[model samples]
Target: MDKFVTRAKKRVGGQSKKDECQRENLQKKPRSEVLKEEFQEDEEVNQFPQPVPWQKIEAEGLDCDYSLLFSKKEADTFFTQLEEEVVYFTGDQTKVQVYGKTYSVPRKQATYGDEGLMYSFSGVHLSARPWTATLEIIRDAVTKATGHTFNFVLINRYKDGHDHMGEHRDDERELDPSCPIASVSLGAARDFVFRHKDARSGQNRRQIDPVKLELAHGSLLLMNSPTNTYWYHSLPTRKKIKSPRINLTFRRIVKQRQRNAIKPS
Candidate 1:
């Protein structure tokens, strides 16, 4: 019986010493590693930001949503690829008609889409160039992210804040009523503003502040439904902003069906 008790006591003491050694080793480990192991499930879990509610502009009855479609690394990759791979044209000194008077537009722009798609705006008609590899990648990602397919993209290059676009509704005849426009911005941030068309009327004298957004890099601004019909959006000039900005507005172009009817030239 004494032999049995001695053996049991030794076993218990050995286990206690082993457990103490393990506890000391654990204490020697970095706190983060210990915590991570303790909360293994939490460490393995991925957390993402919840979608913010759509911002409604009461002045113009426009709904807008902003989302971070790309992370910083993804955005940097895109910016580098765009800068090195894509050939962007500056629409410098491009004459455009405004209120029946011709003037040069302030920035450079281009249109790219599926073959033969034509887009026109701001007294300019841009013929779609075949999509490049980089553009196709971006378009596919956008389609996947937004769950909406687009056949065309309008690329606007603002060399600096001085390269501004005027306030105008995108209610062009060719735009489909239900299609949503997703605008992706990369590089230096810029201010995008919208104002109610009614506020500009001569009879309406009340001051209405324009709703504005500071479009950030890798961010997406989605405009849909009645936004284009009720509000005019613009990128006003800011002389202090020296960095360049690239904006890609993805759009769906309704295809014009070919008719086989004979015509006289």
Candidate 2:
């Protein structure tokens, strides 16, 4: 026991000496100077200019509907349940590809992937699952607010501030151009930025006129005809915020196969 104690003491003493040497080296440098260097390095890396936060400046004629999209308690319960049942995939999550490169999907619960199938990040396609009772309740509320029928919904869960969806236009060939797209946000608030594709030829040239919207819990944002046609939206990352958020985009898809099959018959 004495020999063991002596060996332990010597080991502790050696570790203390190594720590002291490291502390001395660090203390020799000024903290403010080190921080300044880090700040400069960060600024150099992020060169793109960010947009201003969207604000409701004037409420003159805007028919912005403010209603309880879902009960706070119900929303909380649904999120908790979803966190458990949904299978999460990360950037390192592997999948076998049948046609092309197998891209990694984000870390979140998605019920659309095939059994033992791989997913991609670039085109993270999710099929519209059959609406649950909870989802139907919310969907009915949204339909009442927007005055439009939404046949399908694409849900996205951002587990943290780092989990982000890239900039993409939802103007796919499957969707109807005339119908409006309604998005309901729940959980943590996030910024939804929208930028124009043809800024140079149109009014805002060399300028990204982004509508940085703060999607609060149970808030609904309806994008009508012109909005989808003219702008591209993205949910950007903010390292300061650490909470999760869920966004459900309700859409009306016009099946091309159905259209083609009935034409010649």
Candidate 3:
């Protein structure tokens, strides 16, 4: 036991000396040189494709910033990687309750984020899995392009045109209202529609026209503030599209403690 303790002490002492040497070397460099080296190191690790010019679409209560984040070759590679890496919910977990009626979702879905983060809507709760390698790379690229940080990502895979998303607002209580949701699309072009809250069927419905957009492969859409507050968006079905589509919606979720603090007693 004494021999073991002595060996362990020597090992720790050696490691400490090595760390001190590294610190001394770093301190010897000029401040500007040290900073430049650190910056270069960060760049080496954070290399990502540059984002193209973005176009803004504005309306009475909607604001969308669209850009093609990846070229055709890059998008094709990402699409294949995502299809192999993401594992979607199956069977009963894929069903959601709407108006007290349960129905299987048309598209497959998955969630990834920081541990313990969760998102709930349509009477369904989705617990986040740990971020995968491909997802982290994609998330980093989105953040680089949008300058917005996200802790959670919800993935939806549409097998073909028959798969669709119904109109709904993402103003869930757990979502951060101050942050914009960044949506990245891979594979297949589809139409995205946004309807005003007052335009939906009802006695007080207005004549506001729904807004439409064509989301192409490798596109990024930033839905900024006030949009979710008054508009509902959906990917309606088109019978002719045969290719698959994968969408990653990166979001900033309020931490659990913050949500609890804001809740009513």
From the highest TM-score down, the ranking of the candidates is 3, 1, 2
Q: For model 2, give the 10-residue run with minimal summed lDDT.
A: 1-10
Per-residue accuracy of model 1 over 92-201 as CA lDDT, tens digit each: 42667688888877777778888877776555667788876556656765665567898889888888989998988877666666778989999889999998877777
Tens digit of lDDT per residue, candidate 2, span 92-203? Answer: 3323233477644343544322122222223344444455544554565566555678766666788788877666666665566677777888788888877666652655
Candidate 1, TM-score vs. the true structure?
A: 0.72
Off by over 4 Å in 3: 1-52, 257-265
User: In candidate 1, what residue range of length 10 has the lowest lDDT sum?
Assistant: 1-10
Provide the TM-score for each candidate, comma-separated. 0.72, 0.59, 0.80
What lDDT tens digits, residue by residue, belong to model 3 across residues 54-101? Answer: 899999999999998877866776788688778899877799988889
Reference-based lDDT, residue 156, model 1: 84
- Over 4 Å off, model 1: 1-60, 89-93, 257-265
**The candidate that achieves the highest lDDT relative to the unseen native structure:** 3
Query: Candidate 2: which pairs clash?
Result: none
Candidate with more favorable, higher TM-score: 1 or 2 = 1
